[model samples]
Target: MSVDVSKIVRSHEGKRGKLISLLQDIQSRYNYLPREALEVVAEQTGIPLVDIYGVATFYRSFSLTPRGSHLVSVCLGTACHVRGGREVAEELERQLQIKPGQTTTDNEFTLETVNCLGACALGPIVVLDGRYFSKVSPARVKQIIKSARAGKEEHTADGHVFPVKVSCPRCNHSLMDFSHQIDGHSSVRMTMAFGGKHGWLRLSSLYGSFNLESEYDIPLDTVVNLFCPHCHAELISANVCPLCGAPMVPMLVIGGGMVQICARRGCKEHRLDLNGVNV
Candidate 1:
């Protein structure tokens, strides 16, 4: 059946929140929101094309390009950071031989990262084909990548889900931990800033794929962090609360990386590594 791109915008009745919902529906139906579909959305909503593109590109979960049958999303959120989220992002880039926004040549996978998935307790989260993987590590990255490439449908009980690696070429860092904290009171910007974390880079041109590990680390600072882990008076300084020891998780993250992914439908929150965060 032909997908109705226009209906997505029409359903919103020119509402603001619907823009996100509209984009989500469009992506769900088409796997990726086609440029043509976006243009249609702009026309229907009476919104400028630049504005629509900005909206689409603003969120980390939205994908402008088509995705593979199997999609791979590695979380670089805070909890995952201390657990090696950077290594995970880099290794996926290496394994796919493509940057975060680009897809593999074989059309088998797409790699992207997000600042915080609210699974801090499950830091170093990896979402494959929309399925959640919590508490991932550099050592576990390879196997996840392998299994993802091989299309394995399951994981071992020892906290191994899909195989993705996390080895850093500089100083043998091999990131084993990650952290997703906003330190400040404003919404964290996770987009590419002129001199911030998500800006353009000469990653491939400067340090060829074969030598990426030997090259320098790209300076990237997130520009659009908007989620609040919890809505309590003492929301700050918590993967889990210091006072009540309750978990504050993500309801959803609008945008940060290359794609616009939400938490799974059933769980509402992505999977996290309880053991990893405790350690």
Candidate 2:
């Protein structure tokens, strides 16, 4: 579909400096930046093509090429890494036959990696269409993908479903976990997996593949950081609140998991049990 690029550019009020915002708006509408649209923006805003391209490449959030309908983001942070994130990634690549930063042949799904999802307790998690799945295995990956293609709802007769939660200290918003807003129109969530080949956080049923494990070259005790996808706040790395700079305290939830809330009382920029918080 050929979009009216000039209109989108006008949304920025023809401000040449708003190229980044203009591009973000266009990407949200089309899922990828079209060269035609970019050219139109250049013509309307008098911004050079080189400068616009620079901004697009500078952000990992921007995709120059077309993206699939379904985005599959796998987490590769210290916790998920230690638990077996790499193997899960490999399994996804094998099943989808597409590596990280690639899309399936039919353009049904795109597989990519984020550094972390902060659901350490739910290591080895897999998110599909913003929903979370904990303790995923390669075999389970196959089932999930197949089920999606076949238009079957995910009925984990053998797996566990845990909330992957996150929060924003800046806005006091319970940041959507595994979710990152790329453009203004739509937001997406990333899935996380373990690395060490040993995890099944809160499994309920017996899906045959939950017990599967793979070997890895890296150690499981690596350190990492978790950032808020919304406001880009540092939720877990320094053990301090990203908004107020107060120390964070670990508090237990109603069921069983723990969360790190801002220690500052008045500036309680903290949220709880919201999927994908700093784990």
Candidate 3:
């Protein structure tokens, strides 16, 4: 599909700090930013091409090259490394027939290594398509690959779901609403606006869960703008949703790293980046 770069640029016209958002939209449409689209963005927005490239390369989330359908990330942090993270990664390479930072021949999977995933207790972690697998053994690599190829979710170790404590990325203030709990954990509270209606939204603190309580019954596919309850800064990020082409609302994971969720109601696209890890 040909990208209408002009239309995307026009949508963000006169918006401050829109370059990141514009690039995100283009990447979301094409799976990666194409050179032609970058030129078009520069021409239409009057932003220099060099500056555009700088922004594209600066963020680890932005990929200049085309990415495969499924992203496979292995964590090799200090804790994971001692726990045989390298062996797990080597097993993945052996199974997928590709090394780190390389996609499979069929463009089905891209393998990458990250420093950490903030789940130290669960070392030897492997994240496939946003799902976490902890304490992965080299022996399980083949099954994981097969499951991913078949589009089936492999159960995490012990079927455990991790809870995350997040805060406002802007003010560094805790966004955890202890008084309002979801999934038996403190909810991440934020104010939002959608379809001209403003309301409070509380999201489940669980990483893999998508349960959220909102003041309004937001219609499906309604893209909302989220703001921090304490700092009032917009929670918008430069990244776009992988599943839906909508802006991602970002929050700081209490320990270290960031968690972003799709702003479009009913879209469960979310990502967890830890210690500069991008997957």
Candidate 4:
């Protein structure tokens, strides 16, 4: 459908950090983000199409395609997952006859499952529109669907927060729980980085290089250093490889945290703790 993206753009002139608001307005108008509108936004705001699309795709609230009148968000967070949230999702898929990230044929609802929604105590939760239903059972899927279609809100609960999941850049393995321990001294800052508010990663058999994205005058990787296998991007480092004497790649363990690993082809198993960057 044709949307007047120009109107949205005019209201959000000088579109710098207001990308979220711009996308939200567009979604509110069309019920989803249309490609044409995104292109128009890129043309008017001088932002790259990639950047616009990246922002739109990063957030859970934003939709790249058309949506139904109602949005059904299911929480599969850690706290929720341990409490039969997976079964709840499965029941929803079975009852609704639709998979996650799919809209119903009749355009009544859109099904999407998120990693976390906080509300740990309220495990196995299903959210219709914005209302939360806690302690959901597999048997209650039909009832919940019926209630939503009947225009009646079900039980709701406040949401809570949880830890982030870290992954390897090359293989996308989670590194949240580091099983192997090092006997070296650990600072408070280092502890905060491994389990903080940013992102999580799992680098069991892989190596991490320096991130190189620094606020201060961080130096560049020498010509002798290797690049990341996933992107071939120059690796960043604050520490050197103990075995190879090469620079180890730097990565965010989480917010206020950092990890360095040797990115050499045969040195993928090298994982080390480096100095933490102050947040």
Which candidate wins on TM-score? 3
Q: Give the winner by lDDT: 2 or 4.
A: 4
lDDT of 2 at 97: 94
Model 1: how far is 90 from its true place, Å?
3.4
| Candidate 4 C-alpha error for residue 183, in Å | 41
Of the candidates numbered 1 and 4, which has the greater TM-score value? 4
Query: What is candidate 3's TM-score against the reference?
Result: 0.73
* Tens-place lDDT digits, model 2, residues 166-272: 22323334433223222211122211123434321111111111221112322333222333344443333123466877654322222212244443434434432
lDDT of each: 0.47, 0.53, 0.79, 0.55
Candidate 1 lDDT tens digits, 1-279: 124876556555634245655665677677777888988887777778898789777554566788876666676666677788888777777777877656788888766655554446656777676466666666776787788778685564232222221211111122212222112111121111222333211111110011111112433221122222222111111123233333322222222322221111121122221101111
Ranking by TM-score: 3, 2, 4, 1
Stretches of candidate 1 exceeding 4 Å from the true structure: 1-3, 14-17, 77-79, 157-279
**Which stretches of model 2 miss by more than 4 angstroms?**
1-3, 14-17, 152-279
Candidate 4 worst ten-residue window by lDDT:
185-194
Task: Estimate the lDDT of model 1.
Answer: 0.47
Ranking by lDDT: 3, 4, 2, 1
- By lDDT, is 1 or 2 better? 2
Q: Give lDDT tens digits, candidate 4, residues 69-182.
A: 777767777888888988998888888888887889999978877665434676776767545577888988888898889988755433222222233222323334444422
Name the lDDT of candidate 3.
Answer: 0.79
Candidate 4 segments whose C-alpha is farther than 4 A from its true place: 1-3, 155-279
Best by lDDT: 3
